[model samples]
Every structure is written in structure tokens, then in C-alpha cells.
Target: MGIVVIKLGGSLIQGLSNTFFEHINLLQRNGKKVIIVHGGGPLINNLLLKFSIPVEMEDGLRKTSNEVLEVVEYALNGKTNKDLVIMCNQFNLSAIGLSGCDNLLLEASLYDKGKLGWVGEVENVNTSLLELLLTNDYLPVISPIGVDKIGQKYNINADLAAKSIAKALNAEVLCYVTNTNGVLNSEGKSIEKITKDQVQALIESKTITDGMIPKVQSALDALDEVQSVAIVGENFLNEDGSMNGTVFTKGVVFSE
Candidate 1:
């Protein structure tokens, strides 16, 4: 079977929700190959503030300096990645945590250094290492950090990293475990299903503003390759066991 690349948000990882681990176990038991790409932005930010590294943000993404990137790598790969591995183990799910630089799994180029310093855009995603782990029934937990050919480290956006890995592995599902209750309307209710065209309108009207813009954009980018991209409401999951999420697909129309 192919993989299901799940991009677990930084917030989700921090909360240490048992429900998240339960869902992952279910996926594993169902014979689904799962790979987790996680972010540690909040953790990194907190640590940076503690160290007084002077962090900044623009359009929901952290504008990382070299000092900031160092803290990001340490917190993400060293701390958070290992923590997630431990959590998965407690759930009886064997996990091997890694970063993109481990085996050159994800090659990337700098993404607009003028604005976002040391942030990388994934140029290539080789999934052989991930496949091997999955084939052996081990869940591969990944930190969003890539490297160049000469071994220069770069911080890849979790959303983009997940999408790239999903597309590369031809994953059956790409799920974005997000903070909100799915995509909200002007009235602030969760919209269950949204198409590419509708997304454009939402952006234009500012209904899907802020950090949600990248979530939607990543979903749209993955739709061309993956089976489907699910913008799931993590909050809704806490309220009801059922997945209250918006499904993004290629042929989805407004009528659905």
C-alpha cells in the first residue's frame, strides 16, 4: 500500500493529545502506511524568546534569521521529534524519527531569502528511506528540516514538506491536522467541503485569511498528485469522535 502523509501542526504536537495517537494507531492497524511530518514553530519560538534570539513573523510564517534557524533545528529535530517518537511508542506504534537531511531525503532551495531567511522550498523528495521504514511496519516521524547538496541545513515549512513528500510517495491521503474547526465561512461556521474555485473566492473575500491561506494553498498544491487532501478540524475531533473536516479534491464542485 502507498503512504498517508500527515502533517501534524506544531500546536498539535505540543498538546500531547492521546486522541491523536489513537487515530494514528487506528490508521496503522488498518494497514495504512503512515508518515508524520511535524512542525515545532511554537516550541522554537518559545525557546528563542527564552534565549532572547529576537524572533519575527510575517504572514503567519516565522521570518527566521541564522540564530533563529539554529534554535529551530535543535528544538525540532532534537527535542520535539524525539518526543513524538516516544509518544508513538507508548501507543505501541514503533516510530523512527528523522529530519530531511538524514539521508538527503528532501532536497530544497532557499525560499525568498530577502524575506524568509534560511527557509527552504523542497526541490526533491526521495521516499526510499521512508518506504523502507514503512515496509518494516515502523512509522517514520519527520521534522521539517532539509539540507542542500553540500550539507547546508535549511528549515522547510511543515505544510510544504508534507505536500512534497505525499506527492513524491503518491500517498493515498494527505491530511493537515489543523487548529481551527475546518475552513470557516463569513459567519464563522465550518465549511465541510470546498473546491479549488471556491477557495479562490474565499481568499478574495478574506473569509479564508491568515494562516489558513497556506493550509488551503498546500491542499490545492497536493490535489494534483495525491488522492485527496483533508483539512481536518482538530478542535472538532475533540468534541466528536467523527472526523469533522473539509475535503479538498480535484473534481469537487461547489454543489457538493
Candidate 2:
């Protein structure tokens, strides 16, 4: 097994069961190198409100000003990363928490200054540090704040960050550990497989609507660099080592 980049959504973190960690351990035991990237959106929002900072979003990206950037870092790095690292450690998994700025893991540029201030687009990912940690049997828990060449750190989106890292590492899968049970069809059941083109068509037909649009779009944007992407809920693993999720693969026939 090779590298598998898993992106844990902030909203779903609290509900993650012990079985999830067991699944991770099973993957590690079977020779799959795991890299975890996590988000803390809800925590960030709470802090923003506490500080009286106005929260805003532009196309699913947070609008980060200088003040808000501090709070973002506090929530993601100081709080979420710390808690996740501890969780992994409690499960006997050797883990270390790091930010995108650490060893220049993620190099980014300002996405849109006018619309989404201080938000970043992942210009590139340097996988050397990640490889080093994985080789040493350490799971790297990453927080998605990126740094620029001029030492400017911008708040980045966790989903895109995981995708970029997957590309750089040539990971087998970019697994989004989301709140939903994959993408749902019109019947409200999880579609086992889909193509990015099909996802776009579903969006056009309104079969995939509202919040699901950005999730699928993010997966689509990453397809050029990644071989496949998966969307799964927290309880994805069964006792039998099987998984339930929707996998998006290019140029492949769709099936259950």
C-alpha cells in the first residue's frame, strides 16, 4: 500500500468513533501510509463571533483578514490540530501536528484579494517533509494554513490542501472524511461511483444541489492531479475491513 491522504472535516470530527481510529490502524498495519489533514471551520466561526469579527465566505472559501487570520490559526493550529494529535496518540499511533507553513509544506498565493482576502490557492505542495514523517512511521496531522514566498501566511481550505498534498505525493486516494454519506442521487441514496463530468451534469439538472455542489466541484478540480477521490462519512469502515463511500474515478464505468 502507498500513501492515502485523508481530509477530516471540522464538523464531523466530534462524531468520529473509536472504530475510525481502528480503521486507520488497520490501514497502517497493512502497509498503507496515512496522512491526515483537518479543518476547524466551526471553531473558527465561534472564535470570530467571540472577537466580534464578521464572518464571510466567498465560493466556499473563508474571507480572511489580518485579524481573522490570527483567529483562524488559533482555532486550526492551536486547538484542532492539538486535539487531533492527542487523539491519534491516545490510539497508540505516532503522530505529529504541523501547519502548512512548517518546512514550506504548502506554498500558496493569494486567491482573490478583493473577494476573499488572505485566502490562498495552493500553488504547490512539497511532499518531502510528509514523506520523511511517513517513512519514520509517524502520521502527520496537518492544519491547512499556507505561507507565501514573502512569509505571508494565509488561511487555506482543508479540502484543497489535502488534494494538493495527494497530488504531490502521488497518493492513491484523496479521501474526504465528510459529514455526509457521499454524494446522494435524486433518490437520496449514496451513489457508489461517478465521474466528474457526470457530477457536473447532475449539478446542471439540480440533482446535486446547494452544499453538495462545492464538494463535488472540489473533487472535480483535483481530478487532473489525482487518480481517484472518495467521499465518505465518519463511520465508513465495517468490521470486515470493507468501506462504503462514493468514489469518483475518471474514464471509468459507473457501478454500485
Candidate 3:
């Protein structure tokens, strides 16, 4: 009766297929309270290009500046957030779009003081507002953006944002929705499942490097607090609209 928190990546939200919405509808039918945390890299990048703003990345982490933060908030909160809400409302689901900035729900610290600019890492999550939304059966669609105590707005990584919320809410499940089918090896084969120890091994070997490295690490971290953390394929939508992405847990594996 708790809840499920899904960290839907910006890459997926760039254009989620109808199949995804169907899966969400199914989850709602089953009386599951799902909160969606989203990112908007694609949209933000497009805007940056149009404005002739130079974009930069190191280790897949975007370099945030005041210029980039403006575009990020516009895309993530304005476009991406509302689009997901509209999609759910089409299925008669009550979806309320919001950003982490609302009510200071998410407090953050600059990811890198001298280099990362306004790219902030979550420091604390205020669950009171979210809990109120869920108690009323409203699916809270969230954009990962927050402001610091000094009123400096920061763009948060969606994966970490969702993890924080899930832990705060003591959610039963945390699913990370990405474009890929799931965790893949160097051979580009989907790894149905593996133990946390195995995941660490892959990380050590650099098999799971780059952006994916943080994702897997976050999943493992969530395991200690949440019931389960899954990295699933976006295509795994249920017939009734529930999510069907591949799930990862303690030693959970599926046959390819």
C-alpha cells in the first residue's frame, strides 16, 4: 500500500510510444500509486542548439551554467512534465505535474563546486507534499529541478531524484525506465538479471561504465531501502498498460 517510484529518463520521454501509456494505465487499474520523475536532455539540447549556446559534457554529465539551467527548466518542467501528464490524463488518470522546486521539496548541493556549475545532487527530499498528492489518488508527475537555500536553481539528475523520493517514501518498488531493453554487456546483450555482487564486478571491470555506471550503482543503493529496484526495457508495457520492463533485484535473473 506504499507506492512505486519510476525514474523515467529524458531519453525515453523524448517520445514515449503509446505502448508506454497503456502500461501505466494497467498499473493504475491495479491500485498502484506511481510517481514519475522525468528528465529532458533531448529538449534541452535542442534549445541549446537553436540559441547557439555551446553545450558540454564530461563523463556523460552535462556542464550546467545559468544559460543551460534556463533551458533545462523550460524543457523539463514546462514541456516534458506537462506532456506526461497529458498522456496519463488521456487514459482518465489524474496526473498532476510538478517540479522538485515546488515547496522546496528537494534540497541539493552543487555536484562539483568549481566545475559542475548549477548541476546539483540531491541533499534532502521533502515528502509531505508528495504524500498529500498520493493520498488523494493523484499520480504526481515530477520534473527533476530544485533550488538551493540561496535561491539558485539547479538541475537534478532524474535517476538520483527518483532514488531519493523512493527512499523517503519507503516505496515498494523503484523502476528506472530507459531507452535500452535493460542492462547490457559489452556484447550488447541484455543481462536479464544478476546479483548485486555481480553488478559490482562489472563496474570494476569497466563493463558498466559511463552514465550507466551511476544508474546501476543507484539501483544497488536503493535495494537496501526499497523492496526492489529494476532496470527494465521500455517495451515491456503490459496489455492493460502496466509496466513490463525487466526487473533487477537481489540475485534476480531472467532467461534471455
Candidate 4:
């Protein structure tokens, strides 16, 4: 069965449409194994505010201090992960919630010499565990919180974490589920397809800005390993199996 990795943006978690879950069901019916990596930025920020802890970010990545890491873990693993699992189960998808730290699902190393304090980049992914779950027909919903060899936990950017997992699994498709339908042009229209080469140009032209930069960049990065990458919203996959989103390809126009 082909594997698909979906990266769900935290902003869209609370409002994901039924159509989104239905599309997941459709993928399963088509014999695809699905895995999900999710972010909890909004929830984390809320908890941080509730605790009066200053929320900090650098280059679109949350700057995680020791105290901030605790909140991040609680919001991501404790709340967001379970919420997504429940949503999946409600849609008749057998979803298993997990943290990147669980069973060493995602091993990591400190990023930028700990400049982003407690933030890390994925060094490895436990594909064996994933395969075992997928083999049993269970969808794994992963929270992007990683741990190092010495038991030190680190916060991982969900988009980058998904890219790492997709690369490790050599997934057939890597989809970033965002609030927007897809990458939008300056005219505010969704571009149906974008080549890897076009990504940098779009960024340069300021068409893709702010939060979308990382999502688009991560999609571009995953294109080297995954056959296809897309940035899409809830109404992404169609009944006919075609996708509606900004598809990233390696110089070839997307056909289906």
C-alpha cells in the first residue's frame, strides 16, 4: 500500500471540515496508509498566555525555553494530540495518538546549537514502529515533540518534522493541511500547481509570506523524497481522487 503523510497546521485543527475526514476515509478505501504529524501552535500560545510565560518565536519557529517546553508538551501531547485522535475516531478512522518522544518515534539533535533553546531538528524516525501500526491498518497521529539520547526533550517544528518522517518513509505523498486552500498568488487566487523551482521565486516576490513560507519551503524540501507534495485546506481531495491545492512537483506539471 502506498503511504501518505499529512502535516496538520494547528490553526485549522478546531475547524477541520467533515469533508477533510471523509477524504481520509477515501484514501484508506483506495488502499493508502495515512500518517499525520500535527502542530499545536495556537494551543501552546494560549497555555503560555494563561501561565503568563512570554511567547517567543524566531524565523517562524517557536523559541522554546525550558519552561516553554513544558507548556508546549502539555498543549501538544496532552491536549491537541488527543483531540485530533478523537476527531479521527469520530470519522471512523482508527487513529492512534503519539508523541515524537513515544518509543523514540522521532529522535533528534539540538537545532542551531540550542539558539532556539530546547528546539531540535529530527535526526531519525522510527519507521519500524510506523510500519507496524500501518500494517495493522491504524492511522498514527503524531505530535511534534522529540527527545534526544540523554532523555532531553526538544520542541520540533511540525512542518519540518513531517518532512523528516515523509523522507524517512519515502511516502508517496506529503500534504500540509493549512487554513488556506493552497498557495495563493498576489491576486489571492489559489495556484493549482507549482514547481520546486517556482517556490523560491514566489517567496522572493513576496507572494508567499509569513506563516506560509515554512509550509511552502517544507513542501519544496519534501519533493526530493516524496513523489508529490501539496499545501491544501480541508476541501483538498476530490471524490474523483484528484487533489485541489498547490501541488509541488520536481519540474513536471501535475497530471492527476
The model with the greatest lDDT is 4
lDDT of 2: 0.84
In order of appearance, the predictions have TM-scores of 0.91, 0.91, 0.89, 0.94
lDDT of each: 0.83, 0.84, 0.81, 0.90
lDDT of 1: 0.83
lDDT of 3 by residue, 131-194 (tens): 8998899999999898778877888878888888899889988888887877887798878776
Q: Per-residue CA lDDT of candidate 1, range 123-239, in tens?
A: 898778888889999999999899999988888888889999999998988988877767888998888888888899999998887668777888899988898678885542433
Alpha carbon lDDT at 251, candidate 4: 83
Which stretches of candidate 1 lie above 4 Å from their native place? 235-243, 251-256
Query: Which segments of candidate 2 are over 4 A away from where they belong?
Result: 205-211, 238-242, 252-256
Report how far off residue 144 is in candidate 4 (Å).
Answer: 0.5
lDDT of 2 at 174: 78
TM-score of 3: 0.89
lDDT of 2 by residue, 1-256 (tens): 3887888989877667897788889889989899999998888989999999998875567778899999999999898999999999999989999999998888999876536788887888878788889999999999999998999998888888887888888887678887788988888889888887789888888888644665677777777777668888887765775556888877666599
As for candidate 4, its clashing pairs are: none
Instruction: Give per-residue lDDT, candidate 1, residue 252.
Output: 36
